[model samples]
Target: MDSGLENIVAAETVLSDVDGQAGRLIIRGWPVETLAADKPYAAVLGLLWDGFFPELGDDAEIQAQLGRARAAAFALVGTFPMESGVVEALRTGWSLLNDSEAFDDAIAFPAAAAVFTAAAVRHGQGLPLIAPDPALSQAQDLLRMMRGTPASDAEARALDAYLATVSDHGLNASTFAARVIASTRAGLGSAVLGGISALKGPLHGGAPGPVLDMVDDIGTPDAAERWIDAALARGERLMGFGHRVYRVRDPRADALKAAVSKLPGTAGRIAFAEHIETVVLQRLARKYPNRRLETNVEFYTAVLLEALDIPREAFTAIFATGRVLGWIAHASEQIGEKRIVRPKSVYRGPVPEYA
Candidate 1:
């Protein structure tokens, strides 16, 4: 059996598809690039929920529901103590949600839960939790919460673009984990919690934060080559270079880089990151020659998020904020299809012998 079921097709889905060789991602018939620029998070949510929640209300109603739900979640944050990491706080907040009476079959139910959970976790760390503004979009609200105030139009727009860009990819590790949990007929909250848990691992959503760490350690473009070289020699996997899906550069990398361009103060970081990218690529090409270790999504993710003033500890939580849309959509799709996702594994050890 392949560890972690690599290369396994566990479910049939009409969700997003990850074309690694082509460096493309298609979400519900739209290219990720189409949504990554200026599309509000709420709009993308509607798109992701397509064919799953046909009865979902209009944008205004959905936004109102999200705001109400977020406010409700804010009140509960005080009940769960904040000691573990942000991911743990998110998970615990979601677990507490299981007791909510308003948790019926409403479309806004899960969305609200995720927003509040993320905000509460951040708030518990003594950061102010900005209440959701019906006047703002989902991405804007997230940024507002993280920054303890309203985001500038450019900042909000950049974050919206980033969130839309990463909202979904065809059945990546976290999505797979969500689907596995959903296969048991668990609630959407449980599935999303599973997804968040999977993403918290360093190999997945946690990589972006360390990319910044790597950049900070290198301190200069001239030092990047030596730093990466030493790390490679020690057998440490470069944090932001490779991907499980894409053999080449991640398409999302370019998309996010472009999105952050419109924001002020991002230019310098972008240039520095580009220099690091060049150094890393040049060193890798000279050293390995055959291995296709190109920049993946995490490389630019660190730069952009850091420029936005997002704390490194909060990186994975923010990732979850974007990915929850995809998780909810997939969960709804799985439930509608009436399929229990079970896969058979071939046993390799000695079988029982007949006497």
Candidate 2:
């Protein structure tokens, strides 16, 4: 049995493909770069959910529906106490969704995720909770509610690109978890809850926050090389330099790095991050030439979100905000197949003795 399930093919999908050796990502017949470069977050959702939800018509209609959904999600904010971080609050918010219908959950899950995450952030800062703006795009509205003002076009676009880049990927851990729940004929809300819970694990969604920690500890461009050398010498795993799926550079990294570069007032930070990346990659190459330890999505995810003024702790929550759409879409696909996902395992333990 393959303990890690490495190189195992479990299911077929039309959503996205990860060509690890080629360092390419294709989402719904479009490259990730193309989607992130031009399309807004809602448009990506349109692509994913197309033909699945006939009720969603043009982009205008889709955006309007999402706006109303956000309003609906806002109505439920503060219903639960923020006893923990935003991710947990988001999971709770997802649980509170009464949507059993796939399309309904598709609309409500992202809406509730954004609202709950923003509300949780505000609660942590002792600031009054802000309402979702029905007139704004998902990315724009998220920033507006968090900062209590409209985000600049560049700022909104940065988040939009990030959302697009991560919207869907081939059968990832969280997506697989979501699809498993959906295969059980569970509703979309239940599937997305499973996705959110799986994403909270460090091996999945927790690295982006720690990438910021790595940058903060490195402190400066001049110090990056030495710190990386010491970290490698001590056998500490570099936070964002490698990926489990992508054997080469993560395509999402370049997509997000470009987005971060376009943001205002981030030149110095970008240059410094570039230097640290250069040093880390060079050291990694020398340390293990056979393994592809190139930079991954989490590295640039931290940079872009930090430039967006999001707190490090909220990183995973925002990732959930972007990824929830993909989860619902996958669930819808799984539900359509009418097959429950179950795999047999080898019995390695000693045979039971019978009298």
Candidate 3:
């Protein structure tokens, strides 16, 4: 049995594909680079959900539907308590959603995901939840809600790039969890809930905050090599340097690095991160020449999200805002399948005869 299911093919999807060998990612038919650079979050969502739904419309129409859904989700902001964690608070907002089996739920889940995340960020700062503006795009509305004002064009575009860049990948852990729930004939609520739970694991979506922490620890480009060397000597896993998949550089890294670079006031941080990245790669090469532990998505994901004024604790929630679209589409894709996704296990424990 493959313990980690490495190189295992589980489910077939038309949503996205990850070519780890060549370091490429295709979402629907569009390359991730173009999606990040040229498309809005709504356009990518439209692409992913095009044929999966009965009446998925043009990009502008989809944006309108999601706007209504976001407005609907914003109505429940003050109804829920601020939980110990931001994700929990976000989940609480989603739990209030009505009609999980309805077609509107698909649109509502992502709408709610973004709205709740922005609300959670504001609540954490001892601020009130700002109501959604139906006129603004999804990215703009989210930033507006979080900041309690109009988001600049640059801020909205950067978030759009980030959300679209991470909209989907080839059957990741959270996606697999979502599909498993969907396969069990569970409704969309259960599927999305399961996805969020899997994404909360630090090994999966919790590294970005610490990537910034690493940058803060190093303080300057000159200190990067020494800091990384000392950390490596202590056997601490470098947070952003490697990935479980991606034998080459993760394609998402460059996509997000470009997005982060385009934002205003990030030039110095980008330069510093570039220096640290170079030092870390050189050291990692000298240490483990056989392994391709290059920069992964989290390396620049931290840079992008940090520059967005998003707090570390809210990163996973914000990631969920984008990925919930994938969850909904995948669940819709599995509607006709009857398989229960039961994998046989090999028991190695002492199986003595019970006379």
Candidate 4:
């Protein structure tokens, strides 16, 4: 048996393709770079959910519906545990969703993510929760709700790009969890909760936070090379330099790096990060010539989110806001398959022998 199931092809989907060797990502026939540039999160949602939800008309309508969903989800924020961390409070918030219908859950899950994320962050800081505005786009409203003020056009666009960039990928850990629940005919909200639970694991959704830690530790571009060498000498894994799937540079890295560069007042940080990145690559190349260790999405994810003034504690929740769309789409596809996901196991322990 293949213990890790790395070689297994579990399901067929028209959602997205992840090419590790080539370091390319395509979602619904559009390259990730193309989709992320100038496309709003609502538009990406429209592309992923097309033909699945008949009620969703166009990008504008989907944005409006999502806005309404966020507003509806806001009323339930009182039930969310105020004392818990943002992710936990988000879990409580999502657990309270209506799971009776897929269509409703489809709209509600993503909407709730943004609302609960903002509310949880505000509650943790002892600040008042901001209500959702139904007319605002998802990215704009998410930032507005979090900060209790409107985001600038560039800030909103950068956030929208981030949301679209991470909307979907092939069956990674969380998306696979979502599909497994959906295969059992569980409601979309339940499936999405499974995704969230999986994402909560440090192995999946924990890298971006530490990228900032690494940057802070390095302190200066001139010190980065020596710092990286020392870290590697201690057998510490450079957090953002490698990915499980990608042998080449992650395409999403460039996408986010570009987004970060366009934002105002990020020039110094960008240069420092680029220096650190260059040193890391050079050292890795010299240390292990055979391995392809390049920058991954986590590196710039930290940069962009930090630039947006988002608290590092809320990184994964922000990620969930974007990735919930993928979870919903994959759950719907798995539900349509009408077959449960079941794999065989090899028995290694005690076996019975009959005469």
Candidate 5:
């Protein structure tokens, strides 16, 4: 009866592995650092969906197909009202993909799902959803659709880097949720939707947005230590500072910080964030000598996404957009094995009642 299933190995997988103690993530035989340095989002997708998706031409062909699918999804966003929350809008838009005759393939699933989710959320805000251009990369196309204009080369590359870095992580909550859905023989879209639902939880995807809120409240670097100290004194958890898994700083933090550095006007914000990080670390070390409250991925995720012009509320949805690739890959991996993901539970409640 391990509460929360700690240390449980519910399923076997060949997907990415999260090594918290080592502060490392290995994805499909490649270190995350190597992938971030050399590959684009399309290439990472290729690696993740290797065994599941049949040889889908090359990176160029996959990019083109995804662009076309995105445009198709954008056209359908108007059918669903945008007044609903982003998750609901995304879920509703995903149902529309079922109308397509060729929605079963793994390759097509992620491409269309990314498009539909982004467009649906944007459309719900009464914003115009841009059509995807086959000429552009997936990251650029996503930026174009979200911003209603083509992203600058730096912005495009920054986003590409972010998507590539975040495309997958070893069996995290969302990926596990995705695997559970896929084990039921549900389609890729269903699995991805399940992943998104899990990511929407505050403990997961909700942290990044609150990082921005925390920064805004602090107003200046000089005030960071005091603000964080007061919050801690009040029994409040500081957003973006600690991680559940990593004892040291999150490696993804460095990757995202580098990516955001390429965006215009981001240097100053990065510097300010660095100051906050320094203050928080110093304060935490002094206040709780035994605690390891290091900077986590959410710290820089907030800065990078904010620099990319993504609205605070849209952070999780955008996270879902990138992580959808990993979700699909895990789902396919689970389906290939054809096993149910039901884990055993230790019942501690009352015995059977008399009927």
Candidate 6:
């Protein structure tokens, strides 16, 4: 048996594909780069939820519905414990949602993620939560809710790109969890909770924050090479240099790098990150010529989020906001199949010898 199910082909999907060797990602029918650059978060949601949600209409309609959903989710901000971790608070808030298997219920997961995430951030900073504005786009409202003011168009656009870029990929760990729960005929809320639980794991959605920490630890462009080299010599894996998949550079990395480049007041950080990225790539090449260890999404994810003034601690929760769309779509697809995901396991434990 393949312990990790690496070679196993589970369920087929029309949502997204990941080509590890080519380092490509396709969502619905569009390449991640193209989709992320062109479409807003609402458009991507509309694309993903087209056949799943009967009421999901055009991008404008989806935006309006999502805006209302965010406002509805914000009503639970008072229930979340400020002492709990952001993700834990998010989970608590999500648990309170009605599991009616309705389109509005499914949409509430992403909406709640953004609302709870923004509220959690403010709570940590000893500030009151901002109410969601039903008029603003999801990305703009998310930023506004966090900062209590509107984000610049470029900033909101950069965040929109990020959300769209990471909306869906192949069946990742969290997505697989979501599909498994969905296969069991659980409601959308249950599936989303499964996905969020999986994302809380460090190996999955927790890398972006550490990438920022690594960069901050390096401090300067000139110091990057030495810091990385020393870390490598000590057998510490660089946080953002390699990926479990993606034989070459991650496509999302370039997408987010471009987004970061378009933002104002980020030139110095971007230049420093580029220099360090070059050094890391060169050093990695010299060290392991056989392995395709290259920059992954987390590298630029850190850069872009930091540029947006997002706290490092909230990076993973922010990831959930984007990825919740994929979870809902995949769950709906799995539900349509009407098949429970159950695989036989090999029992290597000692069998009882009974007479």
Model 2 scores a C-alpha lDDT of: 0.88
Model 4, position 347, has a per-residue lDDT of: 77
Clashing pairs for model 4 are: none
Q: Which stretches of candidate 1 lie over 4 Å from their true place?
A: 1-6, 98-130, 350-353
Task: Check candidate 5 and list the clashing pairs.
Answer: 82-124
Q: Please list the residue runs of candidate 6 whose C-alpha ends up more than 4 Å from where it truly belongs after superposition.
A: none
lDDT of model 6 at residue 201?
Answer: 96
Residues 129-220, candidate 1, lDDT per residue (tens digit)? Answer: 55666556666676676677778888877877778888898788888887777767788777877888888887778888888888899897
**What local lDDT does model 3 show for residue 292?**
92
TM-score of each: 0.91, 0.98, 0.97, 0.98, 0.93, 0.98
Check candidate 6 and list the clashing pairs.
Answer: none
Q: Which stretches of candidate 5 lie over 4 Å from their true place?
A: 99-104, 117-125, 352-355
lDDT of 6 at 10: 95
Candidate achieving higher TM-score, 1 or 4: 4
lDDT tens per residue, model 3, 13-90:
888988888999999989999999999988988888888787778889889988998989888878998766789987
Instruction: Write model 2 residue lDDT over 239-347, tens digit each, in one string.
Output: 9889887898999999999999999899999899899999999999999989889999999999999999988878999999889878988888888889999988988
Which 10 residues in a row give candidate 1 its minimum summed lDDT? 99-108
RMSD of candidate 5 to the truth, in angstroms, is 2.3
CA shift at 83, candidate 5, in angstroms?
A: 1.1
lDDT of 6 by residue, 1-355 (tens): 8888868999899999999899999999999999878998889899998899888889888889888999899888887585777888888889999875799888888887889999999998999889999888989999998888899999999999999988987889999999999998879899999999999999999999888889889998879888999998999988888988789889999999999999988999999999989999999999998998999999999999998899888888899999989999999999999999999998889999999
What lDDT does candidate 1 reach at residue 174? 84
Residue ranges of candidate 3 with Cα displaced over 4 Å = 352-355
How many steric clashes between backbone atoms does each model show?
A: 0, 0, 0, 0, 1, 0
**TM value for model 3:** 0.97
